[model samples]
Structure formats: C-alpha cells, structure tokens
Target: MIVARPVWAGSLSFGLVSLPVGLYTATDSHTIHFHQLQRGTSDRIRNRRVNERTGDEVELDDIVKGYDTGDEYVLVEPKELDEIAPGRSRSLEIAGFVDLSEVDLIFLDKIYYLGPRGAEYGKVYSLLEQALEKSGKAGIATFVMRQHEYLVAVKAENGLPTCHTLHWADEIRDPKKEIGDLPGKAKASDKELKMAEQLIEALSMEWNPEEFHDTFQERVVALIEAKRAGKTVEKAEPAAKATGAVDLMEALRASVERARSPKVTGGKAAGPGVIAEKKPGAKKRIRSTPPTDGNGG
Candidate 1:
C-alpha cells in the first residue's frame, strides 16, 4: 500500500494509553482545476495580500492573526497561543467514547487516515483499533492541526484507526430555520406511502460505486483532447429533459411495471456485494423491479 506523508504528528491519549500516531490525508480530489486569466489574453490573474489601509503588499512573516473586538483588535502571537495549547499542543486527547451512530452525520467534516508513527507503536495502534471496532464505538477527540484546534472523531477504517474532523455543535445550523416554509408536519396518505415504497423497491440498486460517472468532467476532458489534436470536435446532444412529477399513484404503478419486465441482464454490471458471484453463460435475466469501516482512534 502507498503511504502518504503525515499532515500532523500527535499522540492519541486516553486513560493511561498514549499511542503515538500520525494523520495522513485519506482522499485526493480528481476534479479538473483551472486558473484565472484575463479574457482573450494569457495574463494570469494573481492575488496578493496587501494592507487595506496602506495599500502595500504584506510579507508572510509580518502577517499575524487579529480578532476584531469592537473597540480594538486582539492580536494573538503564535508563541502565545502555543503556550496555552493542550499538551503543549502536541497531542490529541480522547475526551470520551460514544456509539459510532450516536454522532450526527451532519457534523462530519473531513476524514484522514491515522497510522502508527513507527514499527514500535504498531501494537498499541492495533489494540485501540480492534477494541473500538468490537465495541461499536468512536473516540471523540480534539487536537491542533495546521495551527487550528479541531473537534474530531476517531474510528476504524479497514481495520485501522481513522480520524475525521467534525463541525462544532454550534456551527451546525437548524435546517428548519435555514429553509423557508419547510414541510415540518407534512404527512403522506397511506396509499401514497405504499406506492412510494414500492417504487423505491423497483428502482433499488446495489452499492456499486463504479456505475456512477462524472459525465460532465469526462466531456470536458474530451473537449481538451480534441483541442490538443487540432480536430473538429462534435458537440454532444443536449441531455434529455426531465419530466414533471406525475400523480403519485400513477408514477409508482408505472415504475413497478417497468421493473418487472425482464431484459438482458447478462451484460449488466453488478455492484460489489450485489451478488456472491456472476457465472458467465448463465441465463440471467433482469427483472424489472421497482424500486429502488472506520475505526476509532
């Protein structure tokens, strides 16, 4: 396995257990990125930090964080902040453990893989991962990373402890208040509910992530390739327009009928864990159905 460079070096501390660990980024984005430039020209658009009042470009060394305090700004020096940081700001302390599901999905932020700092620390790391996995618990912890103290949850991912930073409780906004006229007390009729459920059943799919594609991104790449080749590129046909929702009952019934009609399933790609195995030459038919790890640290 390819190991990534550690983003932070810290120890996971709990009742008499301090396992030295390093946090490495777990994911990398694959989206194509672009740079800003002047229209019709190659002049790159650049951003520079300048003092708003002085209009002078500021040096990185001279930049310091300041909090607006109504009357004056509270300037905090890095050294001063470090002086009051937890464990001299070098360790992540597990404040407590909770059932993994107890944490709200809304609070989840970013994930990172955790690894033992060295071969000697492997034993403690494995012990913690296994214990948390068996208990169905996650260790709630906090630590400084990139000069900011983050609230995080530690859990196992593929038999190893993984860290996921979370949003502070106060940071989560109430959806009811954020959205206007949300159907807080909306109710569905029994027939409607049943039809909805049946429709979901017909269209249900296995958790095969490979079937999904970033079609837009693929088209963008194709465009770039055509330009590189100096060939005339054909524009893709416009996407099929989405139909308006039908009367609930009609939509559900049609969906069920569509699912029950058998089709060529022999070449259909199955998702992981969808079927134990696929046997070639087996007379497989698609039934129209309707419907449709982590560790603790």
Candidate 2:
C-alpha cells in the first residue's frame, strides 16, 4: 500500500474526547480546459470588464460587488464587507455516531483520510479507530475547513480515520417538484417484468472500477492529438435518438431485450444502468423511448 502525506494537522473531538489527526485528500480530479480563440483570425480570446448599462470599461480598483434589488436599483458593497466572517479555524469535531448504511452515497462530496499527527496523540487516535471499527459504525461530525464549517461522516477505514462530506437534508432538492408529472401509472405485464428480471440476472457482473474509462474525454484528447499531427479526425457514428412511448409493455420488452444483449450492455456481462426506474422493485420502469419532439425518428 502507498503511504499518503498529511495535508493538515488537527484534532477530532466530541465534547470531551479528542484525537490528534492529520487530513489527506482521498482522490484527485483531472479535467481539461480549452483556450478561447478569435472566430476567423485564430487569435486568443481576451475578456474585459465593462458596465452593462453604460457600456464603459471598468478598472479593477473601481469594481465593487453589487446586488440588484429590482426596478433598476443596485446595492454596492464596501471594501470592509470582504472580511465579513473571520475566525480561527477549529479542528474536526465529531458530535455523534450513526450506522454506516444510514447515509446516502450522494451526500458524500469529498473524502479525506485522517492519520495520527504525532506520537503523543497516537494512543487516543488508535482508541477511537478501534471503537469505531468494533461497532462497524461511522461518526456524524462537523469540521471547519477554509473558514466554512462542513458536515461530514467519520469512520475507521483500513485502521485509519476517514472523513467524507455529508449532504444536509435541505441540500437535496425534491424530484417531484422538478419532474412535474410522470406517465404510465399502471404497472408492467407479468411477461415484461419477468423478461426484465431475467435480463438483469443474465447481465450481472462484479464491480471492477479499473475496467471503466472516460471515453468522452479520451475522444476529445485524441482529436486534439490528431489535429496536432496533421491527421484527419475520426468521426464516430451518431447516437440513436430516443422515442417516448405510451405502450408500457412494449417499452419494458425492448429494455429487457437490450439488457440481455451483450452488445447493448457493453460486454458479455455488464452491470445494470443507473436509471432508478429500471432498478428491480422500482414501481415504474423508465424506458428510453423516442423523444416527444421531432428530434428523434
């Protein structure tokens, strides 16, 4: 196993109990960005700050944050407003404990591994780790990082304390409000449902993260490389358009067939798709029918 270097030294607490620990990021992201260029001349793009209403170029020092209160009125901020919230950051404090299964995976925004910071705090940190491991539970905690207190989950992972960001209840928007309404209130036919279930079972496979790759990003990079080498860019086949359908039975049947097919499922055996409706025990099956608009044929 590779050892991780600590990024921040701190202590975790819950009323009286405290453990000296260090934090290290659990993952890293690599995203590609493009530089803008002029449409015809191929000159690099440049941005300037200008007053929207007056069409005047504004200097950096002259720029001030503002909010529109409506009716063409604006509220400008003063320089002192930048230091609105200021205080010495405190270490992670675990206020409570919870079952590991209770929290949803979507709530986790970031992950960090906590290591024992010093020899003196080793005993206390070890004790906490052991207790959490023994109970097979995680601690519900809050930590102040970058001046903002974040809700997090703390648990013992591979003999080390691990922290993951938590999503508050308010942060989760209600799907009903966004979805408005759904079609096909009726359930699927026995044959359709059975076929779907069989297709799912036939395509089952173990989770191996290494097998996955971001093909979209890879294609973009490959295109750039081809352009640099003065080679022709490959054109991939256009994706099939989706068609919406009112026939619940037909949709389920099509999906079941697709799921069972090796080519459609990505391989001889592939994991289920992420659509919640397609999951077993789900009340409704969201099928990829053609679009309601003429975009799909």
Candidate 3:
C-alpha cells in the first residue's frame, strides 16, 4: 500500500478537544502533456520571471507581490501575509457544526483527506469522524495554506474524515446577472415535461465512477501511436445537431428510446475515435500534466 505525503500539517480543534492531523490531496489528474518545442528543432520553450526594462532573469527571493492601483503599485512582502494570520497557518479550529445537507453544493471546492498525525491521536480523530457521520453534520473551519486562507468543511467519508475547501459566498457569481438569455419563468408543456422525466429515469444509473474512463485521453494516446507508426488517424463523427423548439418533443422521445437501448447499457461498440485497447507499457511514456481551468490557471 502506498501512503501519501501530507501537504499540510496542523492541529484540528473543536471545543476542548484538539487532534494533531495532516491533510493529503484526495484527487489527481491523468492528462497527457507535451512540452512546447520549436517548429523545426527540438529546442524547448520555457517561461521565466524577468525585469521588463533590463530583460534580466530575477531571483524568486527578490520578488514581492504588487497590487496595481492605476496611480502606483503597492508592494507587499510574502512574510507580511503569514504574519497577519499566523494562527490560521497552523490551526484548523472549527467554528461550528452544521447539517451537511444545508450546505450548497456550489460552495464546495477541492477536497483533502485528513488523517491523524500519529497513533496517539487516532482515537480523537475517530471520535470526531464517527460523531460527524452519525449526526450527518460537518465541522466548518478556516485555515491558511500556501499563503491563502480557505474556508473548509470537515466531514466523515467512508470511516475517515475529509476536508473540503469552500468558495467564499462572494466568489459565487449570480447566474441571473451573468446569463443574458436565461429562460426565466418559462414553462414546458405537461406532455414534454413528462417525456423528459421518463428519459431521465431511463438514463439514470448507480453512481459508479469506476465504470467511466477518459475516452478523450485514450484517443490522444492512440493518435500519438498512429503518428509514430506512420499511420493516418480517423476523424471523429460530427456531433448531433441541436434540437429546435419545434422538434423538442421528438428529440426527447428519441433520447428516451436510445437510453433504453441495450447497446448503450451493456454492449461495447467502438464508435468514432474510440480506442479498443492500449498497447502494453504505452501509459509509462505518457506524462501527467496539471489540470487547467478556463483561464488556464
């Protein structure tokens, strides 16, 4: 069994009880990455922090965060941030416990596994986990990690405690303000609504994450193999056309039939761009890259 190294170590305090614990990341990415290279050469492209005026590479130690205010930039030292929330950096103090159901799903962000620092603190950890599990509640806390303060909810999952970082309330954008063409107060016909419900029910299945794999990544690997062997890769089929309002009912009915089909449920049919099987030792050559968001952060 492989034991993961902790990213952060601190004491979790709730009321009078405090337990030494460590936080480990609960998720990983398996995206294939390629280095930026010159068009005609194998030379790699790299990023650097350099002075705009001098075009000289700057040492990381000499870099300080600056906030632009139109008139001037306000520089702040890294140590100043830690000094402002010194206790938060090493303490996970629960403010209160709240019903897990009451928390909105949109607020939840990254998840991390929390474990006891040593055998001596296992009992305390277990007690908190069991209590939270039995009560169906989560302990809300705030702590600083890597210079950023995060709101988190510690809850029990599969006999262990898991910490989920939460987005601040203000961070959630109002859909009403952001979406210009939202169909507000629009009502569907009873027949159409009933058909959609049936389609949903037909498509519903148990949440087994193991059943799904990254088909797109597999195609990427297949493309690389095909190119290496001097073979041409087939293009994927075009996506189904969007249904107009006039054809909505017909589309829903067709979707329901498709959902109930045996091929979609049990049979393995190689559709466009589907790779049947990966070659042995092929995965070893693939490099894992960090997952990026819309802004490429």
Candidate 4:
C-alpha cells in the first residue's frame, strides 16, 4: 500500500514517556462528482464570491471571517482567530485512559492513522498500541491541528494505533430537543414482539464491510459511463412501497419470512438490513467527513 503524507507531525506524551508519531488520514471518498452546467447549453456554471451589496467579485485576500450579531456582521480577521487558537505544542498529551465503550459513538469524530515518526520510534509505538489493546482502553489526549485543538482517543485498530477526534461535551446536541412530538408508551402485543425478536434474530449477522457497498454511487457511475458512451441511461428503480402504520404486523411477518427464506437469506452478512431507497431527483447524500461539520463520517 502506498503511504500517505502525514496531515500533522507530532508526539504522543503520557506521564513522562513521549513517542514521536505522524497523523495520517485513514479514509477516502468514492462518491461520483459532477460540475454544474447551464441548462440547455454547454456552458459550465461557475460560482463567485461577490459582495451582495456592491455586486462585485470578492478576492480571497479581501475576505474576512464574520459572525452575525442579528444587527450586523462582526468582521474578524484570520490572524485574530489564529492568535486565540491552540498553541503549536505538537504534542498529544494524554490526560488519562478510559474504557473504549465509555466514549459514546456520538462523541467520536474523524479518524487518523498514527504512525511512528522514525524507525527508532517503532518499539515505543508498538508498546503503546499493545498496551491499549491489552487493557481494552483508549488513551484520552488533546492535540492541536489546523489552528484548533481537538480532544481525541488513541486506540489500537488492526495492529495499528489510530487516533479518533472526539466532540467536546458542549458540541453534542441533545436528541430530545432536536426531535419533537415524542411517542408515548405504546405496548405491543406479545405475538408482535416475539415476531419482531425472531425477525431480528433471523437477520442478525457479523459485519463484513465488503458485503455492503454504496449502491447509489455505483448507479451514478454507471449513468455517467452510459452518457459518456452516447447511450441512453436507464431510469432509477422506484422506491420501496410505503407501508402504513396499521401494516406493522403484516410488514413484520413479511420481513421475517424474507429473512428466513433460503433464497434471500443465504446466511446473514452485515451492515443495514435493506439498502436505502433513494427518491428520484432527490439529493444524494454521501458518507463523508467534510471539515466543516467536524464529527468525521
């Protein structure tokens, strides 16, 4: 495998021991991308950063970060933000260790592969990876990168130490507030519950990332290939029929039967039970961690 350039060069320090390391991105996107074009024309659509009031294109150097105060924009210079940014200590200072399970999935963000900075550091690198693996714990550390500091968990994955940036407590939003009209207690019939349990048991299987894939992305690529060949592209398949709430038991029965069927079952694989049915003309959402959103996909 080709090694990638490290995104950040740093050292992981715990107690008095320090291990020089490099943080490299661990994932890549496979989504099909397209350029915008003017309808009915070959002209490509282009976006420009222009002043709304002046209707003039704004240059990158003239742009300043701004915060809205409801009344007006509070213009802030990039240097001002950098001045308050985390120091360039280049050290991932481990504050403590915690059971990996204790850290909620919601808090886990982007992942990066941690590699030894040099040949001499291999022993120490392996030492920490082995320790964390044996103890079943993740070392909690804070590291600064890209003008900001991140709270991260370092743990062993596939014999390699990986660093996972975690969201601060305040950054996590409460689901209760985000989701409204909570459903009250509604008891299901014993038969219904048993059928559901049986359905789950029939569908349960070990995770095999290979078994699942981005079907939508594959479809997009196929479409692009057909267009490039000057051939007509087929229409997308219709979405699964929407069942009403009253059909819950009926749907459950059908699902259970499907899971138990030899033709469909072929032994459970992994990931989602059913692939997502995308609506025609609807936006395609890719599983990617863009820097803006923070929590890495």
Candidate 5:
C-alpha cells in the first residue's frame, strides 16, 4: 500500500500531555482541469508576475506582500508575519473540549486526518481518539500551519481522529441581513402542511453516501471521448418545470403517490418510517436530523 504524505507536522497538547502528530488531507477533488490556450489555436497561454509600473517580469523571490492604507501601500516581508504568530508553529494546543452537538455547523471548514507522527506515538493517539469517542466531545484547538493560524476541532471518526478547521464566529454572516426576501414564519394551511409532511415521509431514506456518484462528471468524460472519436453525443433532458402555487397541493399528493410506487423505487416501496394520516390536534414531529458532512463548510 502507498503511504500518504502529511501536509503539516506538529505536536498536539492537552494540559501537560503532548503527542507528536501529523495532519494529512482527507479529501481529493475529481475536477477535470484544462490548460489555457489561444482560441482556435494550439498555442498555450501563461501568466507571469511582473512589476506593474515598469511592465517588467519579476522574480518570485523579489515579490513582497503590500497592504494599501488608502493613501499609500505598506509593504511587509513574509518573515515579519511569521515572527508575530501567537504560538509555536509546531504546536497544536487544545483549549478545551465541548459536546460535539454544540458545535454550529456553519463554523466548520475543511477536514484533515490527524495521525501519530510515528509508531512510537500511536498509543498516545489511540488514547485520545478512544476518549473522545466515548465522551462524545470534540477537542477545540488552535494551531499554525504554513504561516496561517487555524481554529480546529479534533473529533473521533471510525477509530481515527479528524481535525476540522473552524471559521471565526464573526465570519458567519447574519442571514436576515444578507437575505432580503426571507419569509419569516410564513403560515401555511393545515391541509397543505400535512400533505407536504406525508410527501417528505414517503421520500425519506437512510443516508448512504456510497449509493451516489457524480453523473455529471461521467457525462463530461463521455463528451470528451465522443469528440476525440469525431462522434455526436446526446444532450441531457432539461430540468422539470417547477409547479405553480395553484397546483402546489396537487403536486404534493402526486409526489406522495409517486414516492410510494414500487416502479419509482426499484421495486421496493418506501420504508415503514413514513408518517401516518394526520390526526386532529396531534403534534407534528418533523425529522430535523441535518447531514453530518457536506460542502457547506
């Protein structure tokens, strides 16, 4: 088996205990990138760093970051930023542990796999992982990587620990301020709501990421292959037109029936978790379990 390379190496500390660890990227992109070229020509296009005023090419070592202060640009050296970092570059210090459920999903960013740096540190790593799994808590920590400070939560996942970078609290925008036309607590008729709930119940299924694949990417690859062989390719069907408000109730009823049909679900009907007929004055218990992983971060 091929071993993965660690992107960042550091020591994780909790109180007086410290364990050497490394952070390995846990995800990869399947995007097909293309090179820039002149239109209708095979000539490649390239970008270069240059002095804007002189219109001359500049070497990478000569480039320095500049911050504009309205009147003038304040140039700063790369080393100056590193000197002012809050803590040791190789140290990841845990501030405290909090219940995993308490972490707001909005604050999460990228995830990395945290592993012991060497076989000697495996015991320490396993101890932390098991403790976190049993307690159902995540350790909140701060560390510096590549001259940038990161706020991260270390949590246990499938016998390993994963480090999830978190965004600063102030970084999240206020949705009410950002979205002007949000309908706050808009009331719907009980009949329409009940029908909608039944539709949701009919469509509900257990989460299994393995069941899904990127069909669009596959289609793109097919298009490339077809073009290479000088063959025509069929286009995908257009998206279904949305139902109007006048047909909303009819749409919901039809959706519930369609979801319950065996032909629509590969010969198996919707599971027994579906909600029953609405009873008068009964409480509505909608499923509120948000997905654990997504691109929101």
Candidate 6:
C-alpha cells in the first residue's frame, strides 16, 4: 500500500457505515517546464506589471485579488468576506451515496485516491468497497477543500474508495444553448454507416492506458534535448495518410483494423477493484446499454 501524503482527512459515511479516510490527489501534471527567451541573445524574458499610460514596475505587496465589475470597474477587498468565510479547512465529509454512472462525465474535475487513515479503519473501508462494487454504486458528498466547498463522488476503486471532484451542474454550460439545435438524422448512406460500424468493431479492444502517449510533451522534450546537445532541432514529418477507403465508413474500418492489430495489444490498465485472482480467459466488456441508477448510493 502507498503511504499517502493526504491533502484532506475525514469520514465517509452513509447510513450506519462510516470509515475514516484520507484524500490524496490521483492525477499530477508534472511535465517539463519552459521559459520564454530572447531569440538571438538567449536572454530569459521576465514579466513586469506597469501602467500603460505611465511605465513603472508595480511592487508585489501592492497586488490584491479582485473581481471585475461592469465597465472595467473592479471590486476590491471587503473585510466582511473574511468574517463570512467557511469555518472548515481541509476536510472531506461524505454526505450520501449515488450510482456512479448517473453523474455526467463533464462534471468531473480532479481525481484523488481515498485511503484508510489507520489499521482500525481498514475493515470498514474494504467492506464499503465490496458492497459498492457488488451493487454498482458510488457515494456523492460535499466537502471543503482550500476553503471552497465542492461536490464530490466517492466510488469503489481497487479494493479502496476513490474520490472525484465534481463541478456543480450550473457550472457546466448547456451545449444546446451554444449550438442552437442538432440534426436528428443520419446524413450518411446505409453502406457508409455499416462500414463505420464494422470499422469500430474491428478496432474495439480493452483500454490499456500506457498505449496513449502525450506526443506534444514528448516532442517538446526531444527538442530541448537536441538544443542542449548543440544539435539543430528537426521538424517532425507529416503523418501518413490512411489508404483503406475514401468515405467515412472506410475510414472507421481502417481505424478499427489499426486498433485491433498486434502492435496495439497490451499495456498498463486500471479499474475499480483489486484483482485478487485472475479469471482465466475473461475479458472485460463495456455495457451495451447504460447502467441503471443504483438507488442505495
């Protein structure tokens, strides 16, 4: 088990079942960083805040967080805000249970791993995971992180519970409002659709995350390495074009074929539970129909 540097510690409760757990961030964005430089002299560029009308460097102490009101007006600090801030600091309190599938994917923000706080808390944590895994449910709760209240979802993950930060429904924009209205018809021919379906079927495979590479980051790193070695950085060649078919159906089929090839087989993968024992010849499958909401969250 990984010893977690917990960002927050609190209780996960639903009905009579309660367990002490800690939240640790699951995702990290620790890629290499770069700074802007003057091209010929290679001098590092530094930012300075100055009024456009009268050029002058602003002192750091003079900075304050503010909100823009209308007409370029700004709302500055208020002493009343300090008085009414949420009392709780770093704590995640589980409020209720929900079917994991009911929450839309767009609501998901950051993810974190929930670990048992101590040996005594292990049994309840395992029990909750087992029960939730069997029932296909997740716990929905509100918690305070960095003094801001957040809606979160805790679900069974690898014999433990994992927490996901969720954005409020109002925070998400409705596509209908932006796109106006979407067409309700299949514009392509039946043959084209059939080819597309076949392509998807051919390409279908288990999710193995290691296969996906952040090519942009990789390219940047390579360029940096080349520059450090006093070598000329080369531009990447254009990607090869697909040769299978010209229509949409052919394109999908080609994609499927590529996906199912031996080169795309196996890599690191994860799901919601521990693999206590491997089931021989078993393959995980995505449900054809959407999961029903499990009421007992």
* TM-score for each predicted model, relative to the true structure: 0.79, 0.68, 0.86, 0.80, 0.85, 0.68
Cα error, residue 285 of model 2, in Å, equals 51
Local error of candidate 2 at residue 34 (angstroms)? 1.4
Ranking by TM-score: 3, 5, 4, 1, 6, 2
> Which model, 1 or 5, shows the larger TM-score?
5
Q: Give the top-scoring candidate (lDDT).
A: 3
lDDT of 3: 0.83
Show model 1 residue runs off by greater than 4 Å: 1-3, 86-88, 230-246, 260-297
Q: Residues 120-177, candidate 1: write the lDDT tens digits.
A: 9888999999998899999998888766889999998788999999999999998888
Candidate 4 versus truth, CA RMSD in Å, comes to: 9.8
**Pairs with steric clashes in candidate 2:** 242-290, 242-291, 243-289, 243-290, 243-291, 244-289, 244-290
Better of 3 and 6 by lDDT: 3
The 10-residue segment of model 3 with minimum total lDDT is 288-297
lDDT of each: 0.75, 0.68, 0.83, 0.78, 0.80, 0.66
For 187-228, candidate 4 gives per-residue lDDT tens digits of 888988999999999999999999898877776665455434
CA-RMSD of model 2: 12.6
- The local distance difference test score of model 6 is 0.66
Report the lDDT of model 3 for residue 227: 44
Looking at model 1, report the run of 10 residues with the lowest lDDT sum.
288-297
- Cα distance off (Å), candidate 1, residue 252: 2.6
Q: Name the better of 3 and 4 by TM-score.
A: 3
Task: State the lDDT of candidate 3 residue by residue for 139-242, as single tens digits.
Answer: 99999999998999999998999999999999999999999999988789999999999999998889998999987788777766654553445555457888
Q: How much lDDT does candidate 4 score? A: 0.78
Q: How good is model 2 by TM-score?
A: 0.68
Provide the lDDT at 94 for model 5.
93
Give the lDDT ranking, best first. Answer: 3, 5, 4, 1, 2, 6
Clashes of 3: 0
